[model samples]
Target: MTRPRIRWHIPVFLAPAVVIYTAVMIFPLVNTLRLALFSKIDQERVFVGLDNFRTLFFDPIWSEQFWNALGNNFWFFLIHMLVQNPIGIVLAAILSHPRLRFSALYRSAIFVPTILSFVIVGFAWKLILSPIWGIAPSMLDAVGLKSLFAPWLGKEEYALTTLALISVWQFVGIPMMLIYAALLSIPDEVIEAGEVDGITGMAAFWKIKLPLILPSIGIISILTFVGNFNAFDLIYASQGALAGPDYSTDILGTFMYRTFFGFQLQLGDPHMGSAIASAMFAIILVGVCLYLYGVQSRMRRYQL
Candidate 1:
């Protein structure tokens, strides 16, 4: 066979990104993993193998908080998957209608919050939900539903769910945009084909459009999983580092931050913090892998 010329320019063009990624991402990740494997002993770092992880999982003090945080993370993720993604899909479906008026305005209004700063969203929501001098109660009272107004952010039972809904409100546009694009990418011929067979309206959507958007939905699910697990800023900004009323809003990110940096009088433990970070990494990695192997594989088979 004739030899092909090398595309030397490809690697040359990629060199800068490769170098920067290595320095910014790879180096830090490796360092964090390394740190997780060691602990401070006698004012010096010493190799402790998986001792930190052991403490994290089994030690009464750390285990309780760790498990609670892990559970909270799962709940946070579940809320997004159940509420946010479905609502986004519905919104996308509505907006994608051929005769929908001012669809552009509706899209802009919904998507604007996605681009807003998390800090701003968190703070604004906190103020609006405040029991005293807040609009939520006033608005509810105006509609004769003031009995439903409670200090949602301050209650342990409701705090996490409330925060999750706020997050959904802020970022639901992401899934909407993604699904909308996916819907638009469906060939006109496919819709016409469905219509010729007497499929129309909601039937057309459920049978035709939804099937074609499975891959996009799967992608959105994975993104929601990753994003929810990594969530921190909103909780931190709204509820402080403690993620209270009693750490009810705590997730892996906030837990790691508290452990790594220390809050108030609690002393920081970098090794333990790294261990938490490593656990978060493993959880996200395993979830993504499962989706790829379990979900994506099935999706491909179905397509075939």
Candidate 2:
């Protein structure tokens, strides 16, 4: 008797998703890169090769802005790493305590801001910070510290950092939830074993829990890297596309948007815009690859 032929159904199941992904993501990406090769001349697109990238990197005017924005973007990522993740981990630890009361309510309240629109968050912060209608100055005045209050979003020195901190406030809940879930996944018996070995409370967390959560922290780090680099909505909503105060807060996303769609006198330059986008894609890819090969491999070894 002839054996029945085996058939693979997994590809059949995945074909539609693959098609959708190619159509929505991969095709657009390839098209953008292709567009980067052409420049506009008298409103006619002309092949320019690497000219756009040359201008982006080597030209003093463009290079200065590019490097400055890149540096600021790195700083933004660093702030989230230093402040947001640590705070979230701490909150998660506190919330995970077996004896903690109203943990659900606390978690819900803390996470509420993450669901709000960037526009809403930005405008709400703007109003609260407005020197005239806002309560911030008055509240500071009540504490005799009104001198410290200023239009932070309007200041060149403070605008980017201020927006970074505001973003941290809104998204800290994500890390908190991830870490909380990771912490909960640890076997209770292992924790009890730690307790028996004279490890309890902070000692238990630092010695036992923290080690187990390193992988989760790595994931959080990479996620923060990608998110901070791609961040545009909060900055745009609060500071506008120009990232005002003379472009003090212009990250890659806003810069690319302004480059792609002309703002004011500067006509849209699609070629340069695509180059910027390609640069961003390259940066993100490098970051992800580093995390995957370096940090993730080490994490796996530690896990084993």
Candidate 3:
């Protein structure tokens, strides 16, 4: 075979994106990792190797917060995976029905919150869920569930779970849209064949539709995992950087932010903060890798 000529224009076209990504993402990430390897002693930078990590995992003060945040983060992710994706899939399946009226309207209504700013969603929810002057109590009273309406966001036992549900409510549209697209892509012939075999309704979904969308669902799961672990904005907006109710709602993201930037009286510690960030990076990287190698490998994308 003759040698194929390399296209110089390929690099030329790719240069801008490569440069932008390196400048914005890769360089900052590398700098953070480097920062994690050092500490400031008496305002002087000192290389400490893995000492920060050692402290994070072994030292009582730091380790306590680290493990607490990690556990809360996992619980947050679990809640999303269990409640959010299933709800999205159900909504998508209903919206995908050929006879459904005003499907576009239902899709738009469901998706509106996903487009809202995190700050807006968080604060709006905080206000609505507030015990003082909030309508949630009144609404609950209307439904004869007034006794169940507690200040969920202010209670340690319920704060994290409440926030996770709020996040689920806001982002459910993402999986819905993704799975909806995948469902729409299924050829009518395949579905017709499925129907001919007495697979219709939920049966069609379980046997014909679900397997085809496994790849998309895997993608959503990974995305949710990464997003939850990296989550900060909504928590910060709703609960503040303190992640109050005694820090019961703190996740790795808020913890890293508070460490790096510091709160009202706390001094910023960039080195330790970077260490936390690096730890989170590792977690997200491992989760993504598992999804790709463990889950995605088995979910072969159906051609039909």
Q: TM-score of every model?
A: 0.95, 0.94, 0.95
Clashes (candidate 3): 0
| Candidate 3 residue lDDT tens string, 196-252 | 989998899999999998889988998899889889999999999999989999999
Cα lDDT, all candidates = 0.94, 0.91, 0.94
CA RMSD (A), model 3: 2.3
**Sort by lDDT, top down from the best:** 1, 3, 2
Model 3 stretches astray by more than 4 angstroms: 1-11
* lDDT digits (tens) for residues 16-112 of candidate 1: 9999999999999989989999999999999999999999999999999999999999999999999999999999999999889999999999999
Better of 2 and 3 by TM-score: 3
Worst 10 residues of 1 by lDDT: 295-304
RMSD of each: 2.3, 2.1, 2.3
TM-score of 1: 0.95
Which candidate, 2 or 3, has the higher lDDT?
3
Residue runs of model 1 more than 4 Å from their true location after superposition:
1-11, 301-304
